[model samples]
Target: MPALASHRKPRSRTRTNSPAVGLTTAAIASVSLLSAQSATADPKPSIDEVQKKVDDLYRQAGSATQEYNRAKESTAKQRRTVDRILDDVAKRTDSLNESRRALGSYAAAQYRTGAVTPTAALLFADSPQAYFEQSQLMDRLTEQQRSTITEFEAEQAAAAKQRAQATKSLESLTASQQSLRTSKQTVQTKLAEARELLSQLTAEEKARLAELERKREEEARRKAEARAKAEAEAEAERQRQEREQQEQSGSGTGAGSDTGSGTGTGTGTAGGAYAAKAEKVLSFARAQIGKPYVWGATGPSSFDCSGLTQAAWKAAGVDLPRTTWDQVKAGQSVATADLLPGDLVFFYDDISHVGIYIGDGKMIHAPKPGANVREESIYYMPIYGSIRPA
Candidate 1:
């Protein structure tokens, strides 16, 4: 119980540092109830159930981490692509500038050679003055050519704009990559946490736990087989018993015969396929390994005392009304020593709690707050009785 307290705190009835309670009359009642029903020991579940759930959690986290990494890589590749596009814009802009400069040079050369077509100039010039004037005109023409280059540069200014847009895109992609990387890191952290949690369980306990689990499983299988056989027998016996009772009552020979008919009729299906059905009920109980214990809550989520057992059986296609009291009414009374898997074990005088016994001395139930759903020793609780519902 202390170990259970360490994990999940049972807030309603149990508290931190609380001492073990006394096993009084209420506890005795639970044990007696079980004894009056079946004659078998309650078994604990196999360790395999716990291990498989842990392994699955690790696997899920790992898969999510891998997906995040892939997304990060995709963002990185997009960033590189954006960068390459920006580089292309830069080179194109430089080439355009060079083209403008070359155009200016050609225009200036044409102006200086103005032979009136530059040749006409050579004929018409009468003095060195004329030649000097032409040279001056050539300088003016070079200025016009410069203006033309400026206009061409302005028209092609789109390169700068495109480069700016590309730069923005590159920045965006880089930011996206960073975000994805952060996501990947977060998933890795979760995986680490899960792994650490699993590591806390000792190897020896796991092995012993597994052995217990295997035997328990075998026990369940055999019991199911036996129950099937028993049910057939019980059904036959019930029918025979009922017929005899009917004959006696019809002849008005005995009132005792009427009681027999009622009893036999009610239990006609007893032992018939009860084990398989019980196994299913137990199966559902075990599915809730990590579910946190809650106070007075019976649910698919948080569970309290009888809530866990009732819900577990419900999942297995058995309808158990909520509350321990309601559950106690479902099965045949069996002695505690005769309790086995599929039997309902009760606790407390008020029947505040109950669990489905698998085999051995352990039973699976949502013990209390702070403890995950687990198998506990029958001796751990003030066990009252065992109820076999077939």
Candidate 2:
């Protein structure tokens, strides 16, 4: 019976496509290969590495930001200068036109009177004898001719001077425009590179990095507070010693005491009465706390390091230079030991960063992008120098 059943036609089996079989094999192989590759892939960067990389990028961006700020400042200055020059040029052009009209009128009048001939060619020649003859002949000239010649000569000279001035100004404007373009390109390039570096990280890495930055800033704040406390204590001690010395020697002089300028920093009386100008500057800076740090922004809202300092001083009626390079040279240099509130403290070997000294060891600064204006320890970074602006 089994042999007979086997011999009978078996139910037709459902046919599988040969291509489907091959596809299944290929998919399996592809997945396996991918798995192997992933298993052997290089490990991701450690948090430390990522942190360092982010820090480096931030520093680079900071440098670039300063460059951008300087460029923007330069551009703004040049624009104002250009505007002034253009305005002068326009006025000069009008003057020239007026001169042309005046000359034209003189010529038309001369034509009506049967144009004056050589009249005094030899007299006007550039020779001593001609000069003498011209002086003698001047008495024979009509008042009308003399006035027309004098007006024409004066206008010609003025027109010539204006043309020369306009040319020089045009040249200066061209140079400034070139500088602006260069600065803009440099800013764009640095920002783009920074963005690219930041993009290399995964979302998790970025989150961790941000957390790290927050912790660092927190540490800085704590250190600033501690420093401020220590400075206060030191100042109190100094005053006590000064009083003792005065009592011991019976001297009228208060040794070890500050000038009481209210600008004295480190433990000496900060928050004292800063100069009215300096008070305004400090007020402006304080009001700007929490504003974002934008590279080239000199703002009612955002600012770079130098921009913050510059704007603050400007509000105080002082025109500080636009960049750290120039700002560093703005006023008298003060030793770090003698730094005062409202003083401009510069950082880095390149003098790229700046902040306003707020007494003790704290300073108000626009730290960097992703950070808002905040008071931090001046010693958070290596300080290059300090300057007194007011």
Clashes of each: 42, 0
Give the per-residue lDDT of model 2 (tens digit) for 1-390: 555545667788876778989899999999999999999998877877767766565666667666666656666666676677678767766765665455445334333443342323322345323432444644555676456556645655766776676677667667766766776676566667667767888898889888987887777678767767766776676677778878898885756544454524343443344466677888999999999988778898899898899999999889998888899998989887777678899988878789998877789999877789998888777899999875
Candidate 1 off by > 4 Å:
1-272
The positional error of residue 211 in candidate 1, measured at the CA in angstroms, is: 26
RMSD of each: 28.2, 9.5
Q: Which residue pairs in candidate 2 collide?
A: none
Tell me the whole-model lDDT of each prediction, alpha carbons only. Answer: 0.61, 0.73
TM-score per candidate: 0.32, 0.70
Model 2 ranges off by over 4 Å = 1-50, 76-141, 211-215, 218-226, 245-276
